[model samples]
Target chain A: MSLLWRNVFGQKTGDDSLAGFLGSIPLFAEMKPRDLRQLAALVHPRDYDDKETVFSEGDPGSGLYLIRNGRVKIFTRDSSGHEHEIAVLEAGDFFGETTLVSPAVRTASARTLEKSQLVGFFRADLLDCMEKNPRLALRLLFGLTRAMSERLHLADRELKRLHHALHELQAEGQD
Target chain B: MAESNGLTRGHVLLFFLVMTASIASGLAIFSSASRITELLHTATTGIVLPVLLALVLSFLLEPLVRLFERGPLTRTASIFLVFALVASGLYLAFSWLSPHWAEMWFSLRTDLPRYLGRGIALLKEAQARVQEIFPYIGGFDLPSRGRVLAERLFSHILAQTTGSALKIGGLMVLVPLFTFFFLRDGQKIVRASVGLVPNRYYEMAHDLAWLISRQLSQFVRGRITEAAIVGLVVGVGLSVTDIRYAPLLALFAGITNLVPYIGPIVGMIPGILIAMVDLGIGAQFWWIVVVYLLIAQVIVDNFILIPILISHVSNLHPLWVIIAIIMGGKLYGVLGMIIGVPVASILKIVIIEIRYYRQTFALPLGEFDS
Candidate 1:
């Protein structure tokens, strides 16, 4: 009976499997082992075929998806219908973190590069976690805030570099 | 232009076919409603009601279980603890209230015929006085009509009571058993169900399920709390005012309050009738009882209980609520009337979400064209 239950619902106990995988992700790095187990219980594992769309660019974003195995391409289409590649994500990488705060439309689409396994952690799940364990919810939010701030710093440096290059190009032209 | 016209004609033909099929199915179901009701009363009651009750109980108790899980307990342990707590609470309440309930029941059984007789006599007197003024109202035989209506209602109640009594033992065993399983494995069950959706529609399907579940849980919790508060206030108010069978009246009022628009009025009828019988129509005490019921059920319930507890959960239009209650009553009697508003609200949500998804995607409705 226990074996059948495990086969049907998958093994949910023990911190060495899904909980460990979740802890390896930077976003959930701050969570304690017990907290990881709690969050792992809420994670929904999904499988996708190669070239299958995880979500369309304009689709409503609901949650973060962490790749457990295989590759996913995150891309957006131009106004004239040109697909521009943003990133190729593999195992341990997560996307759609912005939706944890609110359900907004996806700015980019994601599709599997190969047959893939993914784990979804939705906004509703997070809200429920907050009710059940506020401390864990606080740690998650802190991790999310840190990740966003790092991205912001990188973008600011890139913008400054671009501005300097434009000035140098103007100086050369004038000479 | 010719091709466009052909496409338009085909769309029109398809639309008409779909509409005709829907109407035919509706008519067929309507015609077979009596047979369906009979089957439901016999077989379905023994099976379906237990499952339904279990589902409602699990939804109501899930938050508490989650709360307990946050402590030093596993999910399974938390569920068991919740069950134990609820059982203990119910046992205590039963012990405390059982004697008072028995006394109330005995008095009500003894006083019912007198109340009915006096109520009929009062109605006959009113009919005569009205006829003296209007003359066209003569020969109405109001008492006989009232008696017939009363007889039908009594027989219906008796039949329903017998049916429910037979099923109580089964319900006692099944409801808790089903509830325990649901509380323990609800997440696994939901995940397994959602796991079957194709990758393309997975997120949409998941979101829709979550939305529907949230809506139902919120509505159920709010309704139960509102009913309890209304019952308590009405019970205490009547108890202080020399009213007979205050607890029984309050219980009826609480149960009836599950139905929207018409529930409070239905709840007040017996109280009003008893008051008239006891204090004589137009007496000061009778008028006070009438005013108190009005204030308790109408003013307090509408202004306080609904606004605080239920308004946000349902948010259904008054007209739609009335229509749903009437249709529900016509189909499934009192239970239908009670569930009518929530069911309508759910349908409204589904329709709105489907329309929104269709517009947002602009994909062909026939298949996942993208």
Candidate 2:
């Protein structure tokens, strides 16, 4: 509660806290404090209890959520209703960014692994900020595109490996 | 800290502060009532009205500006080019119509009393005819209020010409200046305003803004087209029938069409009166003008114009449109009535969007939907 601790540790629950947190994110690491402050104003802080569903698969995509603390489970449900964990995301990581580029249904469900805090930056707010500060918007957009491209490349490798495995299983069956 | 019923001393203090602030504001408002009203009036006439008129003009002219910009001209150059074209077009129109307008003006000024006398005499003759048919209806006790209203209506239309012209002239000078800035910075201003929405309802707010902007702009475009077509139709019809001041009546028809429901009736009045005057009561030409206007109103305005142009833009119910016009007229007179439908449409979209979001999203009472 002391000002000294708040200032020195950057643990304040406000613009300064948000700026410090955002500064560590790969996308916003180079952003000026002033610009980050503007971004901070647009972020909505949400608290989640352990095992709470952050979002369900097939739900309409909203925006990206940056994990301020704790962890999240990204998983998918198969036809038989078994959940497959895609990834476990920790603090400083973000998810559900496809909504920023376009309105899309969530491909995976997200749930909190423990008590957590998150900061959401909605698509609409991002677009609005872009109009006001085109340069900053472009930088954020570039970061998003690069992140998505990397994700696609990883997905492509996994898909090809699965295809090879399937062909090999078929050849064994034929022999 | 002290607490009563979960209220802390801090909460009590804040409540009292708010109450004090409210009381102070009320007292201040009451004390400066006259000054506030004067300021409001000045602001409305000087800034709001001119800006609104300029916005409407820009809506009508922006397409032309865009078209010119495609012809290897910068946006500024294109805007200026369109302005120059508009100025020359207005000059040509003025030159062409001046003699007729002057003749009509001369007749109006010199023969207004005579015209009123004739109009009254014609009304009396109709009254006598009705009395003859029903002998129980004796000498008419015409209500003083009705007579005053009739006098006011005519005086307002004919006598206030110069005063209204001066006001319009002032507005004309101011409108272009505001419109230029609006055209140049409209998108940035819009984005800035949209950015003010809270994070929870951010997407909904943006969608609502987009919906309203699209609908309103479409409404404006449709209205301009409707007005031009209606004006041309009325003008050509009147000219064919050899009606006096055909062009002027057509212009009136076009301008008044900006207001929904009541406009066509208002547009038809001067033409009807002129017909009654120029051709004696019960004359053939008078009947022809009446029939022609009826056809135009039915075939043109209601059927063709509304359906093809305006119906899709707002989709405002006729009852709501009427209510909006009445409320708007009461608040802001002519301008309010003209803008009422679009404003109402915007409000409808906002309300609907909010309702939808409330139902779909997890909305706690008194807080934004998430």
| DockQ for all candidate structures vs. native | 0.41, 0.08
The digit string of per-residue lDDT tens for model 1 on B150-259 reads: 76776676577668777787788999999999999987898789879987777777776776667677777888788777777777777776668888888888888777
What value does the interface RMSD of model 2 take? Answer: 7.9
Candidate 2 global lDDT = 0.74
Q: What TM-score is obtained for chain B in each of the predicted models?
A: 0.79, 0.77
Model 2 misplaced stretches (Cα beyond 4 Å): A1-175, B1-38, B69-72, B111-115, B129-140, B143-147, B154-159, B280-294, B334-342, B349-370
Please report the candidate that would top lDDT against the real structure. Answer: 1
**Tens-digit lDDT string for candidate 2 (B201-300):** 4445655565456556667788888888888887877786656778888888887777666777788877777777876566546654654466567788
* TM-score of candidate 2 against the unseen true structure: 0.65
Candidate 1 lDDT over A1-175, as tens digits, reads: 9899888987555435888889888988788887887787888888888888888777777888999989999999888877899999999999988877876778888889999989988887777778878888898889989988988999999999999999999999999
Residue-by-residue lDDT tens digits, candidate 2, A1-175: 6778757975354434777788778867657776676577667677777877777776556688899999999999898878899999999899999887786667887888999988777776676556555766877787788888989999999999999999999999999
Each prediction's interface RMSD?
Answer: 3.2, 7.9
Residue B364 Cα positional deviation in candidate 1, in Å, after optimal superposition: 10
